[model samples]
Target chain A: MTDPQRIWTAAAVIIGDEILSGRTHDKNIAQIATWLQVQGIRLTEVRVIADDMDAIAEAVNTLRAKHDYLFTTGGIGPTHDDITVDAVAAALGIEVIIHPEARAMLEDYYETRGGLNEGRLRMARVPAGSDLIPNRYTGAPGIRLGNLFLMAGVPHITAGMLDGLTGELEGGAPLLSEVIGSWVPESEVAILLRDVEQAHEGCQIGSYPFFREGRSGANFVIRSTDPDVLQSCVDTLCEGLGELGWDFTPGGI
Target chain B: MTDPQRIWTAAAVIIGDEILSGRTHDKNIAQIATWLQVQGIRLTEVRVIADDMDAIAEAVNTLRAKHDYLFTTGGIGPTHDDITVDAVAAALGIEVIIHPEARAMLEDYYETRGGLNEGRLRMARVPAGSDLIPNRYTGAPGIRLGNLFLMAGVPHITAGMLDGLTGELEGGAPLLSEVIGSWVPESEVAILLRDVEQAHEGCQIGSYPFFREGRSGANFVIRSTDPDVLQSCVDTLCEGLGELGWDFTPGGI
Candidate 1:
């Protein structure tokens, strides 16, 4: 919020073995990428590290230094493999101790169903000088230290924390996008595109070609914040492409 | 193939609107990652870039420079959304031309059918100075320039090209691994792991913790080529963990 014009960049460190081993398909990275894009935050790089202390430490240090924000998902649960808290603390040169607020939340969540033991209370560990990113779905609140936000790997829980974080933080303009698609060969219009791109200096243009076994076509997308510029570019590009024997339309299979 | 000691690394660049929109679940990245890992190749990075030219170009250039091999899946189809070839060509600073060999293959594939047109021939456009990575599933061959390998986004076709590429190249020693799992708390056994890591200099040790509802456990994996060192580390780590009221056994979910 300090500098309103500054572009926000983020990097994700997906820490788990289930992802690397192909045993569990990860939903966090893609979900986070989509969410961040909408907020005008660029997700520059993502590293999928196995649950290793050294590996986690290395990634945390590198990512935390490079990106504006570093979000680590997984390894926050109260399991034996959940060492992200300790590793992150080590990376930041801080001490991780059980926070009183987190402990109270865990205790309150467990009180309805008997109570939680010392092992279950492991979720209360927080690195020194960190604030809890309140988790709306469960008692295990995500912890944030400096620019690094550590949240649960579960899709619902991570999403819950993201909602809370998005409301508090400032972001850039949301990216605007529009798609124009049709069944046309990419070759015939390849040269014409070189000129369109040169002309549109502000917009980000994307052309995608597809094939469904027996059928073939291509899609052209114009993405920019300026609505007038986007509409004009899409219109002219479509007309130019249509003149070159392309079936330019709003949508295609 | 020149340096046998050099480990092979590949990055997956997934280009598609379907993937980004969550319309289609991606199976290609995991499939390729797992296959390459078994072959002693490390897949460290994966990028999902939309059908945008600038995005694709930027990702292509970065990944091509960083990794030993770059594997791109998607955006090479015959539909309107497939712009992978042209973008890749632009990224490599080459002209997108219809290669004689690629044309011949596509021609042969559709010789019996009449739907093949100048539009369908778009699949034949290959970047200059690139080898064709044969697609066993479809006649559409993937392009390989320098260390960058461009293949279809479809899981079957990507897997086919990957299989063919693996056979053609020579690689370093295959990575070997052993898992030491237990249903115990990590904090109580952290000291023992520190000792085991200190003793095992060569092996890359990793620990993962998981929990289902209230049940929790962790798996410690020691990966290295040296069988003796791996065995010794696994034995010591597992035995030490057992001393802390942990029950570790192989493949015990």
Candidate 2:
């Protein structure tokens, strides 16, 4: 039987030297994770490797073997460092060639601006048996091979490509979450929290310990699919905290 | 022969339900990466696992085996959901009991507030043979076991602990990077860029493709330990970009 809310796992491979050098703070991993969570697809791991062919290929194969889907970002451009397609082909034991559609896009991109340069032709080289992922941001398209969606590293371009393909893919129902805010410290209310968690077998509870000035506190979020069960737990929690003169509000689903 | 600058490969194991659920975006990885880079330590991998005991234990054992140093964040709070200490003990095949030092800190934290609750006592549990990592933010001290640095998930607190320990750890010299920026499209300036890279054997060069208005461009950064080599490469890059009629600038160190 097929589960509608099936949690599919993904391994995101971020290829770039900039991220490693701390020149670029990566925005893709968090963006992708948020998108996947809404679809009930779990981003299991994220690997940020350099533009080296060996490193990219090694991480590609390793991630592909462990995950249901492998999403790679970066190294698909008109330059020497843009070797993602070549590296992916090497990892998949396939040939690298320009697809008819990609060639057309490349020709159109260059012709629209006058003529094609030899360097511009390099962006058309894609892994064999791959489908073109439309890039609305720029003319250089993304590629999809099996479960791997090879995207551009630039945040806007990557976002555009992902948005374009969202409607075509099979995804899970979005997971819902609920949270309760409080000003009670974790240390002051530890046992009551533990008992609440043990009593609610269906929900997953988390404590976020925070501090304002010298005063310490926590925000406890109880998560579950059943809204009724979640509310009941929250009610009990509020009562427990109220008795101790602790500040808390309705939270979690 | 021992290298003058010790570069220990480190893996960060982030244990939290909030991070996994997409409720919180991680600030620790970037902060830690910056800290380690400055200290000459390399962060090779990062794994964000849930608060499940099995998952935490598995990640701890796996990471500790591969990397020279393993830094874990989250699940060290006083709450029952905070299972890092016990999980680390289970992973290392050791016992977890109330460490005298941890207990003393807890006693002080509670005694200052009149008297201690049983829930507060849970914070004292530590894996056998591990030394305490003094926390300057709050009294709840972190622990260190061999290469493993158990730390708080809170950004400010985690940074404080890492900062305190930085002077003691051996590290490589901070990597230097020189960014040569240009507004020309990547395709237009690919050949000369490749020539510049081929000429600079000592430096590592990268292209950061970006788009402004309707035109696309790239920022080429040359990185190396040798200042002369880096400057030479930067000069070649500026000359190349200048030939393309793109505005060039020396961005950073």
Candidate 3:
């Protein structure tokens, strides 16, 4: 009873006070979303929350139940504010246990740099019945419990962890997209855009407007799982824009 | 009697499919978070959801009820995908209507650029009984209804809207922060960080680790509502790092 057409969706919880405090501009949401798209999964939602344990647990529980997979970035570092592990454990109602393999990895990683202290040892802890996601860049590995992935706050570290988990998750057909840009204001051709989208089934068109060099313009992105449908929609959209007396670029502006 | 020491909090919902699909990197979260911090309103949480109506409504209702103010960005353009007005109306159990002032403003703005068409007029639509937040950069105005604010997705336009509403909201004591950087492994001094944070009654220390130029370093940011407490916490953290034989920078790396 497997539905091949079912869309696999995922959600992300970005945990950090620095982000909520406006000190750090988040890079993980884009990084993870792009990576997930390559794996044929759609990122449906993202929540950027503080380091509070209750908020983390609430976001984890809510998003995990609604999506096939839930990913969290941040709060895995060896510091006082690093509370993601404890919060995720509490969310799953599981005990936190130190993984022996992770402990050994940290021991080996810090062998030349520094010895494993109490704070460094804390990174080895994971929720009960969880597995480790390899982090080639750092000593401590990412945590994977059921459908929840606990990734590092650092962008490069999260990239390495995601690289290890690539091709491991089950996904549906990858969503394909084509972009067309025009210098004309979007409102001038809005009705035509709507008509073309209505005529095309299985394709969704997103219009993003911008003002540059004292000129109004917009980039229309057409997305569909089926290549033929996406192509047809793009063609019709381009034809419609042409008829409306607007020149459009093949790719986005 | 109202408590003078009460901390005001706000939450933001970034409503866009572009952001969720990683087609566009989000800028509103940080912009709004920084603005709110300066206004003495703590930005507690942020949710980036798709442009779907139900999703928009749900996020709006959930966050609006929990915080003193809730702001939403995106989905307020002339395209069919711009449905924030309708979705917020549904969330508030109200109707969407064309604001006369907004419509007049648009008419005047488009008179020179182009005549107002059906699509252009769509920007004037707002939730019932909502006030307008002026957008000097654009024709359409941002919507403000009760504790909810609907802003533009474009960074500069949103900046214009935020500028219009600056100092209009009730706020409390602005949070003060100081940063200190050190070229040392955070794990080596983790215990000291925890103890220093514990001793500082009203201060929070956030340790952000980085590796650059073949060296590991961390920037510790301490925040407090009281300026005196913030300075004291920074002094204590610096003392602790100095005692550990680490050369620390007064400002962050």
- Residue ranges of candidate 1 with Cα displaced over 4 Å: A1-11, A15-24, A34-70, A74-129, A135-141, A145-148, A154-157, A163-166, A171-253, B1-6, B21-23, B79-81, B112-114
Over 4 Å off, model 2: A113-115, A251-253, B5-7, B113-115, B213-215
In candidate 1 the C-alpha lDDT for residue A132 amounts to 94
Better of 2 and 3 by DockQ: 3
Worst 10 residues of 3 chain B by lDDT: B1-10
What are the runs in model 3 whose C-alpha is more than 4 Å off? none
Deviation in Å, model 1, residue B88 alpha carbon: 3.3
Give the per-residue lDDT digits (tens) of candidate 3, residues B1-253.
5576899999999999899889899999999999999899999999999989999999998999899999999988898888999999998899999999999999999999878999999999999999999999879999999989999999999999999999999998888999999998889889999999999888999999999999999999999988888888999888888888999998899
Native contacts conserved, per model: 0.10, 0.46, 0.76
Of candidates 3 and 2, the better by TM-score: 3
lDDT of 3 at A113: 76
Between prediction 1 and prediction 2, the one with superior TM-score is 2
| RMSD vs true structure, all candidates | 5.6, 2.8, 0.9
* CA error at residue B100 for candidate 1, angstroms: 1.1
TM-score of each: 0.72, 0.90, 0.99
CAPRI band for model 2: medium
What digit string (tens of lDDT, one per residue) describes model 3 on residues A109-202?
9999778999999999999898999999889899998889999999999999999999999989999999999998988888888888898898
lDDT of 2 by residue, A5-98 (tens): 4667877888887776566877887777777776567776776777888978988998899888888999998887888999999989999997
Q: Given candidate 2, what's the lDDT at residue B128?
A: 89
Alpha-carbon shift of residue A184 in model 1 (angstroms): 11
